[model samples]
Target chain A: MFKNFFPNKILSLSNNLLNSLLVYLILVMFLGLIYSLYISPPDYIQGDSVRIMYVHVPSSFISLACFGIIGIASILNLVFKIKFIPLMSKSLAPVGCTFTLISIVTGSLWGKPTWGTWWAWDARLTSMVILLLFYFGYIFVWKFVSSFNKANKISSIIAIIGLLNLPVIKYSVDWWNTLHQPSSITLTSAPTIHYSMLIPLIIMLAGMIIYLLIIFLMKYKTETIKFKMNKIKNKK
Target chain B: MLGKNAKKRAILLTLLLLLSAVTIFLIFKSLEENIVYFFTPSEIYNKQNISFNKTIRVGGLVKENSISKEQNSVKFIITDFKNEIIVSYSGLIPNLFSEGKGVIAEGELKDKKYFIAEKILAKHDENYMPPEVTKALEKSNK
Candidate 1:
């Protein structure tokens, strides 16, 4: 019954959604900037430097989320023989790596002021480094392996294995004595932050997520087109 | 074509899994000991054969009215409400360093009770305390 839904229409829908989301993304980001800079009160302790969380936290969240997507998409590709899922996973790698890089850089800037140092071999920080290495390793697998099936299988395994790091990263502070603070927000409890600060953080998170979606869709579309073009060339 | 390639792929998959398992095990094993950077005053107090000069981190709440500023150094006591140790630091303190706040000081102990902190990290915000500090506080409270 649902088979009538055509791929062309789905692509067109995503394109339209992407255009509108791009606009919304900019608008939300600007609002987030205003809130982060002006509306939210300086932290009771760290003061203005705490503003970095608006960028740092959202980027960290998105980067970790990207890994989760890559892991899931890889599984679906391997099991269900989905063609686009591998490309989607591949497209996510660079974006995830970029966000992780941003988070690390901003985290350093934030840490230097508050933690009295720019870097530490703290559990949370170390696990994040490992996550970045996994991203690089996944991308390298795709590049090095010439056989398409082999590349997909190996990269998918890498992505799945890398999933072990995500839980460790999230729980590192709780499980180990590290310089990183425990999370202020948790799933079961209300946020520890004030409503004013939390509001801007939410807005920033929303903006970052929409931006990631736009990039993901764009990458997927480009890869699909390239795949089709290569197919035509092979026919010729 | 897939069936022809299955044997090689199976071998590759098994090897990759074994490689990752060993790598992860090594990482966790190496990280296990160094993971706990800070020890509470109670924990430090209860320990025997303590090295008097090895650098360590002591995390706890700053005892109220314990802060005294000198020309170049500041002295205070960190307490877990069960045990306390005096910390002396000759440097610029973090912005959040204040009495009645959570802090972690890294330095060697002059003896068992006096800590000379080379670096001090105060709590980042009202809502955030280093997880170790919270855990130490919880354990000591019990």
Candidate 2:
């Protein structure tokens, strides 16, 4: 069943695709770094410290998106009993965890210059910490649970429960009087940020997303190889 | 096999429903208790029984021309545009702290009208623009 889902041809194609993506990722990252660090204008209030937003915003966004992917994949695995979906979630968990950590760290750095404190127990910050814990819990289940079937079910349920925190994290600023400012760019309204800063931010976001794709593809490939090896051992 | 699948689905659905229900109840309860990160000046005014000893944060805009620097302490009026509270702080303020900018002062309320801030934090809005653009906007507003 796993072999059917990830055939040799598909694996080879993914290898080629990963090579092309790597090239693109390098080029985009170079441009993104240049634009965010030098080309972007300093904020009227924050000056150079505002550059941290280029990294902080993208990491936060990617962390949230990765969890969303994990949650949906877990639900599908549970409902349809898709044998390969667990592999995808397993590959994604670490990437999400790393990005969540990056977001928290960069946010703290940014907070010091702007909010005048290294950390605050504001709703947005606290909820993000909760999200990080959820990611840890999800990864922990997969690591400690030795049985494959039990690990899959337990991790999926953990991912699903973590999904509940996403909305809370997104809405925490608006719902509560957090030190973190409300989102400038919302789906419902025009962005309040100026074009000069917005361009670099978008570029950085694109670069980080490409980086995430690269990492995820590499991890998925490794997991697939491991899965095949396990199956062969079972047959032996 | 179909019965087993149905049973699994039912269990998963019940779990999701129960989890969400509990989450909603907790959120509502927290809201009722008002777990606010910071209270606005207007909110402080609206509170029925105000505490004096407890350290709380009051966030608002620094009223233009309301800043008065003394030898050791700086005094400013924080206004939510509805009500205002006088704040005096001796500590070093954040770089972004200025007239007409948002700020949050953490300290005990001496009274309904006065706040003695132990720490002062600058609160910037979400708007990010170049210095020139800000200057132009400020100029145009005047």
Candidate 3:
């Protein structure tokens, strides 16, 4: 049933989805900001600084999520010889890198007011730093290697290799004793967060994901078009 | 019986996989010791021949009314239900540091009973005080 899913139909669907998603994203982001800035109660201990969680948490989540998509695309490329997967993975690196950077910066801003330091060599923070380096190394391979096949082969390897770090990053808090607290939200149980705080957090998470989707789709479309144009030019 | 190009690709893929496997193995092997950043009070208490003045971390909730301010330092007790350790620190505590809150103190163990903290880390939840801390404090009170 899924065999006839052609590229043209998928592209058009993505376009329509992208338009609505953008509008929805903007509206949701606005509402989320309102709740984060005004509605949520100040933390009993950390006070207003806890509001930084709205940005810091979502950015870090999206950063890891971007790498996850890249890893999946790399796996498909490696196993199934999918032509566009490498480019899609390439498109995601910058988005992942940018969000990783945001996560670190916002985390530092949050840390200063709460942890009394801008940076710590704690496990979570260090693992995130390593993730950022992996993103950079992946992007570096794509840019420095001019041959398409060469870039694809090496970049995919980097993406696949980086997969080992994801589990480490996710489990770092539980497996290690670091300044970073263990995650309160778990898959098997109810979250420890209050509904008032969780609502805005969920909204912001949705907004960030939609934003990532918009950027990733745009990058994918551009790369696909560029490949098609080059092919046509080469034929002439 | 593979084509020449397929043979090369397979070799390259295998090499990459092997390289990544070795890299990950080395990283985790080297990091094994540093992985566990802090120990609970119970974990510390159960250890034998523990040297004093060597730095370590013990994590638990700050026992209520255990904090006493002195001219140069502040002292408090951290407990993990079955065990407790006193921590002394001269520096300013983080904003999140409070009685009945989860904390991890890093410093030399003067003994199992006292921790001269070089640093004190008080953990806070996304919304409020973390639940495990409340549970620990309650358990100790009982």
Candidate 4:
């Protein structure tokens, strides 16, 4: 029982945590480069230009995943009505926004080489732009509303409703044929990606997911601590 | 005062959360299975296909001596250094697309090597050069 409470237990575990995490980061980066450049066989068709999937697909996954967190945090706040819940949701906004921003920025970068144009009004692209706007509105709601309870009130509504755009983004291509190409790998269909390419992609995405988790945990811990400290100070 | 504020806030927050959860669940359920990637011609020949399954991209160079406006389709010779491929695009080619420029058309693969292009991607221009080219040039000089 005493051992469970010891500082050594927690301290020692966390000591090498940073080092092991560093190794994981380097390993993922190396694998990502290797898979895209070497391991992955070129598309029998698109050839090397197909390598953008390594970056684009994973970033899009992260974008979707980040917003999922917002939905969960919002639900927890409602059920528990915990003060901490809203505070955590508030802290999550910037991170989710950052992921969404990366998705759009990289998509634009990849567009120049592939699509031959910097921008398009294509349905998928347009819905994504709307998603970006929703993110801005979500952040704005939190920033402008001074009262914590009131801010939580408004932000929760926006986050839930904003989700309407996610489906629009997905179906935009199927709903209407546009410049954006149709999805290649499907749930029932075999993946069109070659193994050499697929392995590295999976590795890179795993690294990104882990990296996001580490940051989210760190952020949550810091926020919780600050909240506690503020509470104590008020009492004093 | 505190009790009223807390209760009212809780009620509003609950309704919003329930609606949002259902909506987000719908989004997750709707995630697409297939993903697409784009490519350039030279990269296709040199690297092979980069996607997982059957790869797709436009293949051709501007067909020399063949390019002319026949109604909507512009005919051209898409050539590598060795062999030439023929292409017909009905829609507008970007201003950058012209004779002598390398291009890769995207669409279905017809027969053995023929590509029936649905979209045209006109290749490089004076304003653009692959970063790899400069790096490779520098490395060679070194």
Q: Could you say which candidate leads in DockQ?
A: 2
Q: List DockQ, one per candidate, in order.
A: 0.27, 0.69, 0.35, 0.07
DockQ of 2: 0.69
What overall lDDT goes with each candidate model?
A: 0.82, 0.88, 0.81, 0.62
Candidate 3: count of backbone clashes, pairs at least 3 residues apart or interchain: 1
Off by over 4 Å in 1: A1-17, A234-236, B1-30, B125-142
After superposition, which runs of candidate 4 have C-alpha atoms over 4 Å from their true positions? A1-19, B1-142
Q: Write the per-residue lDDT of candidate 2 for residues A66-146, one digit (tens) a residue.
A: 999998888878877767789888988899999999999999999999989999988799889999999999999988998
lDDT by residue for model 3 (A27-141), tens: 9999999989898877656777878888888999999988988987786677667676786788788888999999999999988878777887778999999999999999999
Docking class of 1: acceptable
Give a tens-digit lDDT track for model 4, residues B1-142. Answer: 3467667766776676578767665664574222212333444445443442343654445656657778777767666655554555678576446666656566655433344566776544212223454467679999
**lDDT (tens digit, per residue) of candidate 1 on A1-236:** 12212234334545557789889999999999999989887765676888998899999999999998898777566656667678779878888989999999999999888887888878899889999999999999988997777998899988988887888899898887778898988898988877778888999999998888778667766766766777798899
True contacts kept of each: 0.33, 0.78, 0.43, 0.06
> For each candidate, how many residue pairs have backbone atoms clashing (under 3 Å)?
0, 0, 1, 25
Evaluated on CA atoms against the true complex, candidate 1 attains a DockQ of 0.27
TM-score of each: 0.84, 0.93, 0.84, 0.61
**CAPRI accuracy category, model 2:** medium
For candidate 3, write residues B1-142 as lDDT tens digits: 6667656766776687778878876887788657766788888888887768677778888999999999989999999889999889998788788888888788999878888998877766534533445567679999
